[model samples]
Target: MTEIINFRAGRYKISFHILHILMTEKYENNATQVPSSDDTLLGVINYQKVPTPIYDLTRILEGSSAQQQMSDLIDLLHEREKDHVEWLNALQSSIETGTEFTKARDPHQCAFGKWYDSFKSENEDLKHILQKFDEPHKVIHSLADKLLKMAATEGKEQALKVLNQQRKSTLRLLLNLFSAAREAVSSSYKPVIVYTTLNGATPSLGFLVDSVDDALTIDESDIQSFVNDQAIKFAGELNLPRMISGLITKDDVNSLLIDPSLIDASLPEAYENEASLA
Candidate 1:
């Protein structure tokens, strides 16, 4: 059996031996930069009075990672919220001017509905919160047709009153649900950096990650080393970082195992120097 610490970086769960982790702390924008073409090198930051190289693993991986995805999802929810606000405005205009309702009548056919239908996640809490949105959203959309008919028959005053009532009740519920869902995800999306050293020397490197997940114990059999796999170096693809020694499969999730010394050796020359303050 072996012990490893798992950290989330974008879509991946990456790990290193627990001993390699000197400490983990929330990331700060304190890095000092040098002129460098490598985007992976996020400059150097101060750590316990020693200059440490700060690297963004997401950049090492790609642009699409957990942190970026979380940010985008939050933006998506806000956009959906805006859509409904406009829907309500357009609805009021339709009622006042006898204009035909311009928004879709079917809840499932609307923009937010379509996105909600396609959204997938393992987060049960988020799933539950979003599911609450369905009935209220449907009710809000269903109001247009019914309220318009009421306007023509019983006069606009009563219809507008019903519309405002629904906004206060159903719309209020849906918006609260949105806020809850956003908070749930955002709470867990906090990013941190795992501070590491070369052996027990200076705190030489800091890995910026989406979040630190868990400490895991697994059989040695769960690991597969691919550092020397030439197939990965085939023409269009870049060589796998020597520091990323292997993959460890636990509970069907595959995470990369990082080799600290080799990762230090792999640093771009730009990160070689300590910050002037150090």
Candidate 2:
């Protein structure tokens, strides 16, 4: 028998757990980049004797449309594990007795050879001895399974950790250093770019304009009015979740706030009373 299920998303209400799955997946820059179909998948995982989708929220947020693609990624991970074991065992024996980079076939193999040589030169005899029985394939498979479990158990916390560890401020320094490089590419180009972040996630926008202009700030009350106008139009056209209260622009970034009244909303249901920012 088919059972009906429903969920909340912002102010919009949805029947499919698809919205919940997407919510678990983090979106980049208003859903601009699609996520790579890798990691453990939902849908095929059997729990309590029933098949359940084991979704990686990050991929969903990146706009992965097919569950089968995600399943394929999981299978690929297993295959890689098998290959990793063979490579590690091969590397260990070659390194213990002294492997030669000259005999390596590919760049990756050559790099590994160089690493082993460097390790041997540093008098790391223990590492050299340990390399022979490394059983790298087994480790890779174990790590993959652990990662899948972490994604399933921790959810948003794991997502936040992934975002925080990966987003680097060094990109900002590189951008400033290479400003001249942009002009050298095209003499007629006058480009302006906006660098912003969402919860420590790096986001960028480019604007090609003639010249710089003054910046302005608007009051929160006025912004709310603007959001209401856009929300009315968005709701009509998109058929987005009824739980979506409306699109709101806060702290220079726009987020679709979920309605407090909706039962299926993914946004936090609890709130704490705070006195002031100061």
Candidate 3:
């Protein structure tokens, strides 16, 4: 039941074994720091003290450097922050004055304003910091990881279906890299290649040119004991939220390269049983 994931980038045929961790999570040598370039897909999560960049396999396969991608995403958010602030101000004024638009034009304004106000008040430094420093798309990327996990344990069938849907929704992101290649003197210098692999015995490899990436197999072991128990399910719920994996594709030969030893030894078994019903 090994699911063969194939992605075409120029001429190379990328493939790998998908392994399911029985108990512990492994992130490319247990790394907790975000990768500095497009060649590494895994990132460190920095919810506390230092941020941890969780690798999105699909994005890595697509040729985006984790650090640069994260920074660019933060920049995009900063660019839109002004508009968000304006919208927040208008909503606040409407709510205070009881303007007709308060309810009719932006009914959700109150709730949204409250959310923004909280962030603004607590993190007044956020705006100033954004002006000087930018981070990558870790938040959304993290959310995508969580959602994918949900699809893994709670709804494997449904999750795979959602990934199929994302192919179309994420086309714009993929096109951006191609456009960058066109504008750059050398595509290699442009951070267009995403090097990524799930490290395990029987490691799995995926390639994504832009966002043409799909939900490669998300194989999870050590779940049979918790299949029906609420507590086990709860445990799964807690663990899956932070489990992240994805793929990205690119044109450069070096971008898609991964170390053979990084893959786990038990991957062959994982690949055969990635699907729940299988």
Name the candidate that leads on lDDT: 1
lDDT: worst 10-residue window of model 1: 231-240
Worst 10 residues of 3 by lDDT: 233-242
Candidate 3 residue 76 Cα shift, in angstroms, is 1.5
lDDT of 2 by residue, 17-90 (tens): 11221122222222222122323122232223322223222232333322343344335434433444344344
| Residue 101, candidate 2: C-alpha displacement in angstroms | 6.6
The true-versus-predicted C-alpha distance at residue 139 of model 3, in Å, is 27
Off by over 4 Å in 2: 1-61, 92-98, 101-243, 247-278
How much is the lDDT of residue 1 in candidate 2? Answer: 17
- The better candidate by TM-score, 1 or 2, is 1
Residues 1-278, candidate 3: write the lDDT tens digits: 33323333322233333233111132233334322432333433322232323334433333444335435544544444443334334434433343432221231243323333443311223444332211221221222444445554766456445544543343234333323322331222211222333433221322122222222432333111212223421111112111212222323221122222343231234332321121
Clashes of each: 2, 26, 38
lDDT of 1 at 208: 84
In candidate 3, stretches whose alpha carbon ends up further than 4 angstroms from where it belongs are: 3-60, 84-278
Alpha-carbon shift of residue 35 in model 3 (angstroms): 15
Q: Which candidate has the top score in TM-score? A: 1
Between candidates 1 and 3, the lDDT winner: 1
